[model samples]
Target: MLVVLVHLLFYSCVLSKVYKLQLTHKAKHIHQHKHHKRQNSASLINAQDFDFYVNVTVGNGQVFSLIVDTGSSDMFVRGPGCVSNSGDNSCECDNMLPNPTACVLNTFDSSLSNLSQTAYVQYGSANVNFNIFSGPVLFDGFQITNFPFGSAYQISGLGNSGDGILGLGFNSISRVAWATGKDASIFDALGLTGRQQIFGTYLSNFDFQHFVNDVVGGEITIGGIDNTKFTGPITYVPLISESYWKFNISTLTFSFGGSQPLYLGSSGGGNAISDTGTGQIYLDNSLADRVNSFLGGVYSNVYGSYVVDCKWQNSKIPMIFTLYGVKYSLSSSSYIIPYNGVCLSGISRNGADGHTAFSNFGQVWGRSYYTIYDKFNGRIGFAKAV
Candidate 1:
């Protein structure tokens, strides 16, 4: 079957300013009967921002574990004669990672699979030569054909990243489709019942209390929303554009305990995109500098991010992001990543290597909200995960 598992990384990105909620009256929860009973969903495996991937069985029963990325729209894999980048722990499968067999990955064999012609793909840090395989892609109960993908022969800067990358992005920018002059993306090839083109993501991190993955778990849900993964009403916002899962920013806020939510005021008219592939949350320099100013951190050229006192991890609550009129948030625990006895802010200034221009909400943002991709209606939903 064509299996597509989008594994979001507990990658070393996504950050927030520290906030000490006022110890006035304690926070209380009022139960309400607002539920989105969409039942189609899947599970995800996240290693504390380290990596998120899935077992995808492609053409001719070949299964590959690919990183499910929503940032760019293209797919590629490493096959015969593939090489790895030096110093990348991914290929070596470091013991510190959640998956002890992280390096025990898979690769495609172009010579074995049915093929059409040779093709080349140039993407972020990847340069590959592959064959246009003519076969079916299967997953769950869904089968996709007509659309084709590359079974790479010679690859570089890719296999080292993961088994491969399964791009869950729009077709307008698909490199394989543009090169082959055919619909090569699985997103465009799947023949779903009715016009239901919804994709949902429930991403989680390694909670120390529950070291063997959280009890709630995480995964990418296709078809419709998974009511069991989240609770309450989903905050929906119209997609401002069709290229990416892009949306407009209403306001970014934080507060001192229970004081009135203080607005960042920097992202007033700015826009942001939800990227599953990237681990860090990026914003304009003014906004990042402003957030870091409040968090009281200094930039570290060595790490290409701000280094904060680890103590700030305890004095924080969720950082609020207002889109349209709905509010979504990410807690400081997810952003204030602990490393070598110090914490690094996942929220950083854009323009760094491998970052988008506008504000980008990567896995850090998704860790807080159960993100839903309403492809048919051109909207995105953020349901606060229970």
Candidate 2:
């Protein structure tokens, strides 16, 4: 026919120049992923609750319920087959309390130390015990020496709130897998006073309505994060590759009136974890019951509570998140949870057997909100809330 119509017009001009170079490289990769999620949402970190403190060396008084953890560091107490609520028994020895005469005997005499006195144990049910104590260890006045800790060696009663767990996580070399020995941390003796660095924490002996005041100490400042007890401008998130402490949340979508009931890892794959001890915000019990039946199924199991019912008014509520590619538009009060002012609804699917025993790939963006794990200058920030 005329050389087959000039070989079909030269293969339709080479498939329209490879479809305009794949639509200009996918619109410049969605404008460089919205300019790296607005430059990592400006390194967020609005941390406070009186900065933080919980350095209690060996079961102090009769009160306990501490939990300011960054994922595990060291500072322990809970010995004596713990299982209390005042009925079961075993936890009220205070290592044999007497009367603040500078209460001593925080023993661990594994032969003074060549190394090795292990016996660790931890993870929520809280039956503490795991040691290594060297000490001048005073905290509020800032004193530390070979203090690798965790003790409550089986005391179960403080089961609910807190009593010990202030590791301000970041893998400081060793003695943390719940920690048990080889002593040395407090930023490893701040390099014998040349002052290497100090700043690590998770303060909250109680307040956010958890209420257990005398404020029971809470802190973790190794290098930074004490900006005069938090006012604003401190949003940072970066830490998930020193091999592992944990925090890789690059995706975990969830929407309501605007549609996407639940999406995870998006088109490419999966990853979602923030876990500040995961009080709530775990999806995938069938997308958390289809987003609580698309928001009309109201909810409230009490573990940090979530109610729902703003009526989905203007609709378009979003929850899009993408870490490495950087995108976070989590509106709707960053996933709503108000109370007397009445906006209650924070999305929950009752942790289907705890996300089927830790994700085979389902969903979990837990800790409702308040996820800012800053590392500083090098880069790691994730902001949310006013």
Candidate topping lDDT:
1
**In candidate 2, what residue range of length 10 has the lowest lDDT sum?**
26-35
Clash number by candidate, in order:
19, 55
lDDT of 2 by residue, 1-386 (tens): 00000000000111221100000000000000000000100011111111121324332322222333444455555533444555633354322111121122334444222124554444433434454444344332233445555444454533322234445444443455334434344443444222213232222211234432232222223443334333334355555553123444435455544574355532212333333333334544555566567666555454323466665422557655444455555455435543444444444543435353222111022221233344333234333322
Q: TM-score, each model?
A: 0.74, 0.30
lDDT of 2: 0.34
Note the Cα lDDT for every prediction shown. Answer: 0.56, 0.34
Across 1-386, the per-residue lDDT of candidate 1 in tens digits comes to 00112332111111232111100011111110000112234455454454455545565566555556776666655454444456422233222322322232233434234446776655434466665555555443334554466656665544344456677777777766776676655445664433356777877654644444323236766655556668889888789876778887656564433556656534524677787766667676666776777678787776556798887777676566555556666678877766545687767766544333457777677777788888788888888776
Clashes of 1: 19
